[model samples]
Target: MISVVILGAGNVATHLFRGFSLAENVSVTQWYSRNLTTVEQYKNEVDITDDLSDLKVADVYIIAVSDDAVAKLSSKLEFENRMVVHTSGSVGIYDLDKKHNRGVFYPLQSFTKGAAMDFANVPICIETVDKKSYPLLKTLAKNLGSPVQKVNSDQRRVLHLAAVFVNNFTNQLYRIGHEITESEGAEFDMLKPLIVETAKKIEDLSPYRAQTGPAKRHDKKTIKKHLKQLDDNNHHKAVYELLTKSIQKTHGRKKL
Candidate 1:
C-alpha cells in the first residue's frame, strides 16, 4: 500500500484527502495544518497535527499549501530524503528545500471548496528530479483514476498560464454576461444552454473551427449595435470592444 501524508487544509488538500481515502492501494496516514481547527474534522480518520515535527513516516508527503508557503513549509519538515511533492501548477519543483526528494503533483483543474469533482477526468501533471520517485507518484495518481502527464517545470508553467486564460478569464467573462443581462432585465438563466453548448463544441472541434457569432463573421451591424448597448466609459464596454476586435482579427476580419 502507498502511505501518504497531506499537508494543508484548503481546496486541493481536501479533495486529495478524499481521493486518497477511497483509493484501494493508498492510505492517507496523516493530515497537517498550521491551525488545528481547519483539519479537526478528520482527526477520527487520520493523524492530524499542527506541529511539523510530530508527523509520522510515510511514503509520500504532499505539501498542498499555497505557492508562497510550499518552500517555507518543506524547509520546516523534520525528515529528510523522503519523497515530497506539492500540488501547485505554477511553482517550480526546485522551490522545495534540497533536504528531500522534490517533485510536483499538480492537478490541472480549478478547485472550489465543497465543489464536487471526479479525479478520473482531472489530468495530473507531475515532475520529479529523482527518477526513482516518479513511479510512486504515478502509481498513487493512477489509483485515484487520474491520467498522468510527465511535464518539466517550463511546460508546467505554460500550462498554468493557459489555464488562467481558459478557466479564470472565461469565468470573469461569464460574470460580465450576467451583469449585461441584469441591466436589460433579461433572464441570465436563458444563456445556460448556449454556455454548455459552446463548451461541448470544443470537445470535438478546435477553438478556431468552433468560432461563430457576430465578431467571428465580421457583422459590423451587430458589433456596432452591441457597442452602443453597453454604457459609455464602462469597463464592460471596454471588454466587449476588445474581444470583438480580437475575434475579428483572429478570423482575418478588418477593424469594424
Candidate 2:
C-alpha cells in the first residue's frame, strides 16, 4: 500500500483527502495544516500536524496548498528525496524545487469545499522532473479513476490559461444570466434546459459552429431589443456588446 501525506485543508485538499481515502492500496497516513483548528475534523481519521517538521513519514507528500504557498511550504519540509507533488493547475512542477522528487498532479476541474466529487470523470494532468517519477505519478492518478496525460511545464501553463477561459469565465457568464433573470422577476431555473443543451451541443460541435441566437444570426432587431433591456449598468452593457461583436466578427458579419 502507498502511504500518502496531504497538506492544506482547503477545497482541493478536502476533495483529494476524501478521494484518496476511498482508493484501495492507498492510505492518507498524515495531514499537515498550519491552522490547527482547520485540521480538527480530520485529526481522528489520520495523523494531523500543524508543524511541518512533525510530518509523519509517508511514501508521497501531496501538497494541496494554494499556488502562492507552495514554494514556501516546500522549503520548510525536510523530506529527503521523497515523492512530493502539488495539486495546482497553474503552478508548474519546478515551483516545488529540486530538494525532492517533485511532480504535479493537477486535476482539471473546479473544487468546492464540502462538495462530493466524481473523480472518475475529472481529467488529471501529470508532470514530473524526470522519467523515474513519471510512472509513479501516473499510477497514483489511475488509482484515483482519472485519465492521466503527460504534459510539459509550458504546455501545462497554456492548458491552465485555457481552463480559466473555458471554466471560470463561462461560469461568470452563467452568473450574469442568472442575475439578469432574477432582476426581471423570471425564474433562473427556466434557463436550465437551455444551458444543458448548449453544453451538450458543444461536446460534438465547435462553439463557433454551435452558435445560435441574435449574435450568430445577425438578428439586429432582437439584438437591439436585448441591449435595450439592459439596465444602467455599464459593465453589463459593455459585456453584452463585446460578446455580440465577437460572435458577429467570428461569423464574418459586419457590426450591427
Candidate 3:
C-alpha cells in the first residue's frame, strides 16, 4: 500500500484527500494544517494534526499548499530523504526544500470545494529527479483515475500559462458574459449550453477552425453594434475591443 501524508487545508488538499481515499491500495497516514479550525473536522476521518513535529512516517508527502507556501512548508518538515511533491503547475519542482526527495504532482484542472471531480479526464502532470519514483506517481495517478503526464519544471510552467488562459481567463470571460446578460435582464443560465458546446467543439476541430462570430468574420457592423452596446461599460468595451483585434490578427485580418 502507498502511504501518504497530505499538507495543507485548502480546496486542492481536500480534493486530494477524497481522491486518495477512493484508492484501495492507498493509506493516508496523516494530514497537517497550521490552523486547527480548518482541518479539525477531519480528525475523526483521518489523523489530522497542526504540529509539524507530529508528522507521521509515510511513503509519500504531498504538499498541497499554495505555490508561495510550498517552500516554507517543505523547509518546516522534520523528515528528510522521503519522497515529497508539491501540487502546483506553475512552481518549479525544485521549489520544495532540498532536504527531501522533491517532485511535482500537478493536477491540471481548476478545483472548487463541494464540486464533484471525476479525475478520469484530468491530466496528472508529474516530475521527479529519480527515475524509480516515477512509477509510484504513475500508480497514484492511475488510482485517482487520471492520465499520467511526465512534465518537467519548464514545461509545466508553460502548461500553467496556457491553463490560466483556458481556465482562469475563460472563467473571467464567463463572468463578463454573465454581466452582459444581467444588464439585458436575461438569465445567465441560458448561456450554459452554448458554453458546453463551445468546449466540446475543440474535441473534433481546432480552435482556429471552430472559431466563429463577429471578430472571426471581421463583421465590422456587428462589431460596432457590440461596441455600442458596451458603450456605458467602458471596461467591457476595452476588453471586447482588445480580444477582437487579437482574434483578427490571429486570422490574418489585421489590416483594419
Candidate 4:
C-alpha cells in the first residue's frame, strides 16, 4: 500500500481524505491541521497531528489547503525530499518552490463537506517538476478512477477561468431566476424541468446551436418587454440587454 499524508481540514481535505481512505492501495497515514482537537475524531483510524514535527513520514504528502497557504505550509514541512502535491487549480506547481518533489494533482470540481463525489467522473489535472513523479501521480489518479490529463500551468489557469464562467456564473443566473419567481409568489421548482432539460440538451449540442428564447430569435417585442420588466433593477436590466445584444450579434442580426 502507498502510505499518504493529507494536510488541511477544509471541505477539499474532507472530501479527499474520504476518497483516499476508500482506495485499496492508499492509506491515509496522517492527517495534519493547526487544530488538533478538530481532527481528533480521525485519530483512531489515522494519526492526527498539530505540530509539523509530529507529522508522520509517508510515501506521498497531499496538500489540500487554500491556494494562498500552499507555499507557506509547504515551506514549513520537513518532507526530507519526499513527493508533495497540491490540489489547487489556479496556482502553479512552482508556487511550492524547491521544498520537495513538488507537483499539482488538481481535481477539476467543487467539493463540499459530507457531499459525495464521484472521482471517476471528475477530471484530474496533473503536473510535475520531476519526470519520475509524473507516473506516480498518474498511477494514483488512475486508482482514484479519474481520468488524468497532463496540463501546463497556463492551460490550467485558462480552464479554471472557463469553469468559473460555466459553473459560478450559471448558478448566479439561477439565483436571479429563483428570486424573481419568489417575489411573484410562484414556486421556483416550476423551473426545475426546464433547467434540467437545458443542461441535458447542451451535452449533445453546442450552446449556440441549442440557444432559444427571444434573445436568440431576435424578437424585438419580447426583448423590449423583458428589458422593461427588469427596469426595477439596473444590474438585471444591464445584464439582460448585454446578453440579448450578444445573442443578436452571434446570429449576425442587427441589435434593436
Q: Summarize candidate 3's per-residue lDDT along 127-169 as a digit string, tens digits.
A: 9988898899889888898999998889999999999999999
Q: Pick by lDDT: which candidate is best? A: 1
| Candidate models: Cα lDDT each | 0.93, 0.87, 0.91, 0.87
For model 3 the TM-score comes to: 0.98
List per-candidate RMSD values in Å. Answer: 1.1, 1.2, 1.0, 1.7
Q: Count the backbone clashes (under 3 Å) in each candidate.
A: 0, 0, 0, 0
Q: Give the Å error, residue 160, model 2.
A: 1.3
Could you tell me every candidate's TM-score relative to the true structure? 0.97, 0.96, 0.98, 0.93
Predictions ranked by TM-score, top down? 3, 1, 2, 4
TM-score of 2: 0.96
- Better model by TM-score: candidate 1 vs candidate 4: 1
lDDT by residue (tens digit), candidate 1, 1-256: 9999999999999999999889999999999999999999889998999999899899999999999999999999989999999999988899999998999999999998789889998999989999888999999999999999999999999999999999999999999989888887999999999999999999999999999999998888988888888855379889988888899889997697
lDDT tens readout by residue for model 4, 56-145? 888889999989999989999865588989989898898885969989989998887877898987899999999888988888888788
Candidate 2: residue 73 lDDT (0-100): 86
> CA lDDT of 67 in candidate 2?
94
Candidates 3 and 4 compared by lDDT, better number:
3
Q: Candidate 2 local accuracy as lDDT? A: 0.87
